[model samples]
Target: MYHLSSLQTKAIAFLLTLFSAGHLSGQGLKNYGNNYRDFAGKAYYFGLSFGVNRSNYQIVHSRQFIGNESIKIAESNDGPGFTVGIITNMKIGDYFDLRMIPSFSFVERNISYTGYTNLEDNMTRIESTFFEVPFQVRYKSKPYKDVKLYVVSGLKYGFDISSKSRTKRLTDQIRLSPHDFSVEAGAGIQFFLPYVIFSPELKFTQGIGNVLIYRNDLQESTVLEKILSRAFTISFHFEG
Candidate 1:
């Protein structure tokens, strides 16, 4: 069985509320014409984004875990993270755009288990600082005054820039792969301000590869057959 942590649950709830509020409020809003009337005529536009994220590992236990007497329970925990990125938008059509975002993120994933003696040794923490680039195709609805709704789907590639597993002793550390890839999908509402378009987006990402680096020396690594990345992000984008 799979379960989400409290943090993950709350984040999902918050995003759902945001979506509901935007959809409800939009019903009563009057059309303000095109907020960025002449803006789409340009070939490209640039923007900046800042966001908070929750990240974790999707752990699949090996047969070793089931057979071992020392291991009682195994689970993964999600934690808070932050991201900052530069966005480049290329207009493809009236309702479609190509977006590329190069971002840096701080993330952490934690693993916990219960031993026969209920000791503290059952916890392992992995930290990563990722440099990620995501390429997405965005589809937008017609603007209703200053508001527009959009959906985006894409692929992201990431490299862990702050991974210290190589420099550390294998005996004491849980090692992970430095590279990862994920499928991304999201939806957002764009609110045009006086001078900028402010967008609040909710994005979901699921890693496609097993990022776990198994080792014979580490019991934690041996117990896990695979670990995939999972994340939820709420981003605020400022575009011109």
Candidate 2:
């Protein structure tokens, strides 16, 4: 068996206690507001999502260097790609819930090499696939028995699991260990069913930090290099 240190055990205990207290308090509040407890339940949802993404280099007001080369930054797209994820809902009240989603997505960018010596082409295409997790707080309008609208705000963390690239004259592939974090916001509608609930949601996500690790050199780069796209995702959820 794995043994936890005293401090670790205490931290775990504290978190569990906090979680239990919050759950119990929510239950008590629901009981007191019995008239509004119709939406209290646990649900799991899985769905397919389609979206567009763009990637770009982070531009700094100050000049930066890569292997003694000075480069000017610009943003570009590799192209549109697809996304899919599963979501779990923890109902807190008639108007509030917690949502956790895990997803796999593809991002791409066409990057142009500017102010670089011995580089042949002006641009190349880079594509990457990511595994992402998002934690969201959802607030719903009053449930009208069968239909409701909700807004979601959250943070997402993503890891770049793989990447590939191709150019007009050459194809180069590399494995990147890039990680990303973002804040997301969106709204959607839900239709309740006897055994399942269906929700279609739209979300927008923006990166919170520079996504690149190497300044301009692609050969020795391990970072994602650029953020190719801001995405608009239309996701369908089946919850039960």
Candidate 3:
């Protein structure tokens, strides 16, 4: 027999309570109206989203690091950012919807190096204003009164439109390519109100290709192999 920890037991109990209250049980007749019906006849909708994100890089070391004296180790540090976007959603079936969001993200990411002989520990910062577009497919659970749970998966393309990158004023330590491509996945709960649907979502994006632009003239660039971008975002969407 297996045993559940006290914390696990409490977590399960809490989830059970929410599930019953939100999906399984009903209230008095006075509270039993369905807000979901308001949009039953609509095939499409538009929305706006705003979110906060934490962005970082995934670094892979190169062969040069084995004997490099200037850089002992290379790592990425998290940076905070914000996003604003427009959403377009189209119903594909009773349980599925196709979505596209075009957004702008203002972010800053850091790369730090451990010092070695003839060098001191240093950190480099990369700030970007990115224009991003993502295409996603969402699957929604059956509505529970005015609420529904959904999951989404998608692909994204982003381009850094920051002035520094365009004008070549970036730090001499390292440079990143302006283009980024990623895969995304997320989940959220939707609440249907009298006039609109509001959803709060959490999403993760992972870059599929290296964003590092190798600099042959810099030692800081030689200690690393590749850099990939990653971000975790919390978004709020409002639609009618």
Candidate 4:
């Protein structure tokens, strides 16, 4: 069974309590009216985002990794990353908006491999500087006082501006493609303050294609078949 860490449990409990309080407050019937009436009246708005991400790869090893006598084990480890972005939101309906965020991410991932007869493990660390653009459709719930809940679903296109595939010496290195596409989904709660809207969001991203560039000369690339990217991001957005 997968267990939540103590910190994660506490965080979940806190959010549940907050959501419950907001829901109860909304049911009191007394009109607590909207805070920023003019904010939503605008056709479009811009914002800024700062966030942290936990990134890793979902590996689908080839038959060689399992059945071949020369190969022992192969796996990947998660790494920490950060992001910064500019947010552009276009109002489409009373409850809908089109959102575009162009961002840069600094991420790292590690993969380890072992041979059948050798007890030693070889680990390869990959660093990617990704330029990403996400096109998302956001659906918001009715405002309860000054707070509202929203869900977003989207597609993201990313290019690794610092991919190692083009490096002169690729012989012993694990290489990845410069381009990738992913599907993304997330939910957030918005707090409409006096001057700006503050939102904290949690999102997930999964790659749609293999990002690995395989080379036969490299043993690190030979034991693997497909590599897909996955990440969980937590962001804070501020909009005027």
Using all chains and alpha carbons, the TM-scores for the candidates as numbered come to: 0.86, 0.62, 0.85, 0.85
Model 4 per-residue lDDT at 11: 49
Model 3 C-alpha lDDT per residue in residues 60-163, reported as the tens digit of each score? 89899889867787888888999999999999876799999999999988899888754578888888899999999987766766877677789999999884
> Can you tell me which runs of candidate 4 are displaced by over 4 Å?
1-34, 117-119, 164-166
Each prediction's Cα lDDT score? 0.81, 0.56, 0.80, 0.79
Candidate 3 runs further than 4 Å off: 1-33, 117-119, 163-167
The residue-by-residue lDDT of candidate 1 on 17-37, one tens digit each, is 665666566667655556656
Off by over 4 Å in 2: 1-73, 113-121, 163-177, 216-229
Error of 2 at 142 (Å): 0.7
Among residues 3 or more apart in sequence or in different chains, the pairs in candidate 3 whose N, CA or C atoms overlap within 3 Å are none
Question: Which prediction has more favorable lDDT, 1 or 4?
Answer: 1
lDDT of 2 by residue, 171-230 (tens): 343222366788877767677766556777666666776664443435423223443234
Q: Note each model's CA RMSD in angstroms.
A: 3.4, 12.1, 6.2, 3.6
